[model samples]
Target: MTTNILFCGDASMTDGVLIATLSLMKQTRHPLHIFILTATLTVNGHHYRPFAAGTAERMTKLMQTQNSAHQLTRIDITDLFVADLPRANMKTMFTPYCMLRLFSDLVPELPDRVLYLDTDVVCRRPFDTFYNQSMAGVDIAGVLDHYGKWWFHHRLAWFDYLNSGVLLMSLAHIREDGLLVRCRQLVRHRWLFMPDQSALNIKAKFKRILPRKYNEQHQLKPDTVFQHFTTFFRFWPYFRIVTVKPWQIQAVHQQLGLHEYDDLLKDYRQLAPKLKEVS
Candidate 1:
């Protein structure tokens, strides 16, 4: 069976997505059916460009190199986003593109089960075990946010708050229960700090909290499967938020001091120049 992976972002997220894809490809030999959801939107004066078709074409070719069955499909949800705009959170720190995953149920092409990953993540270990885990009654499966869990919980502070960066979604359950519809309504009408993540936490009826190894947001451990480069706060010298992504090769080497993915980084460096030509 092919693993259905999903990523949502705009054109600015191209490098992150490409590097994340490379990391996944290196870890597992399983047939991957990757779906990239992108959209063009103009909230206020800022215009966001959708993922380029040429980049998608290049990525499709790259995926097939590992396994003939591996495929990459780019789905543009411009019209859907235009119809149901998240008006309340449009001006938040996050771009409007971050809400794209909330429209996944409306996309006819998506599989019943899709693993949604944020662009700023790298796979360190094969996650077929996590991907193939039974989702019989769970609408979504995710790990607790390293930072958000302490403050953003719906009921129990640490137990209910889940990070949206790496989620194993049950699309069938979400559609049947109208989960995304409620999430969309919540974000469109109400202002949330982390709109999508908060809406999911509040509205999802059944969610499974996985081990931290599934989405290790902090320092990477030996058993970490997906290393998420999420923004975290540091208070030693002075209180400041740190943000770093896998695509930031120099930051990953210098700031993060991570050298485990040298092979993947080398491949990303070689392939990155071609993105400029495509864009």
Candidate 2:
């Protein structure tokens, strides 16, 4: 059986998306049918940049050379729900790309189930571990958001708020129950800071919760299957905190001893040029 995987990102995030894709393909045991959600800058002043030409072709060539079953498909459904996106409580860190997962229903030919992952995560274990596991009867399966759990539990009174970074979606269930529509309604009516994630959590509060190892963050563990570089903020080993990403220039590297990850990104840096800016 083919494992359907989904990812969302834009020009600025090209590096993360490529690294994440290559890393996953390196570990997945099953054949992969990958779907990429993207957007163009529709509104004046809207910041989204279109995917570089030949992006999908390059990805497919890279994956197919390794395994014929690896396929890459890119779809842009920005116009489907662009107006429905929330604004009042939207977080500055979020862009239209963050809301792409909400429009999964409109993606014409998605499989019955698809695993959605943030571009920031790198795969270290066979994806079958996640794909093979049953979703039971839930619309979504995801790891609890350790970063936002307390706020969700205390403020929102939700017991099962999930990290949207790594999720297994039951597309059939989502369509059958009109879950995405309900999620959109929740986004419009509720006070949400992380709009898409909060809407999913509040609408599907009973979603299946996976083990922490599935979406492990920052530090790696022996059993961690996915190393999620979820945070861009780097705290000093002893004192101060700074913001840095592994792919950025060394001017931001902290002495916090995370060079191991920076070096990992360097190994895949050769592929970065494929995502060059439109300018």
Candidate 3:
């Protein structure tokens, strides 16, 4: 009865996914069945070996200490019927991976419910509490979007918009309510900064809204279970504003004031320091 966690990404986001997973593993002792939806592997198998062997070994050690274990599963995109999913031509960072999450119900051998996370998030505390909790009556549970006021649809107050980065989805409710079909319909007609995210928000907008602890974005708050890297640029402690990614070398030389997040990414750096170093 291991907890199931899902992530969707291609080569461009593999490392981010790896780091995010390691961060979660670091905080929790509960066994996890990590499901990754990806199509192509990195150019060489090189990027994957270290994460599979080295980082996985670390997880094994931690799990052993806690009397738990974990497994990794990769679901190929080509195996799914996603060839015709509607995608907006907006120049956002949207990718095919974004659309794969909509087909959560189609995932073979999946559990009744699962947690979905974006590659940019880092888990700070144990979430098996929320993961194992019942959704009550909602099909999906998520935190309210901090930037919801900027979204055109959210301004209408149709429903409280939520950031799609972290979601606790109840497959039973989704299938029962025809959520997939509705989400597909919304995706086909609407264009948002994040198409898939916007579609999910529009469809599940009235569902249960989780506490702020579940998905803290950009700003770190007390009792935060998840810390998200929504903003890449910041001017703090430094005289001038600068952009820095913890995964990038700039973090070490520039005073981006993000060292607070070092613990979240330590395993990632030690195991695979370079971009695409882990797939």
Each prediction's RMSD to truth: 1.3, 3.1, 5.0
Give model 2's TM-score versus the native structure: 0.86
Q: Which scores higher on lDDT, 1 or 2?
A: 1
C-alpha lDDT of residue 115 in model 1: 97
lDDT of 3 by residue, 189-259 (tens): 67666777777876763477788888887567779998766654344555554434446645634644556
Residue-level error in angstroms, candidate 1, position 82: 0.9
Best prediction by lDDT = 1
lDDT of 2 by residue, 15-104 (tens): 777778777777876788888888775443666675554777787887887899889888876676566765443444567577778888
Writing each residue's lDDT as its tens digit, candidate 1 over 1-279 gives 888999998888888889898888887888888899998788789888888878888888878877889999999999998898889999998888889999999999999999999998999998999999999988999999888887776775346789999999999999999999999999999999888888999999899999999999998899999999988777878998888888788998997789988898899989877863353
* Angstrom error at residue 121, model 2: 0.5
lDDT of each: 0.89, 0.73, 0.67
lDDT value, candidate 3, whole model = 0.67
Q: Give candidate 2 misplaced runs (Cα > 4 Å).
A: 42-44, 87-91, 154-159, 189-191, 232-246, 249-256, 259-266, 274-279
* Full-model lDDT, candidate 2: 0.73
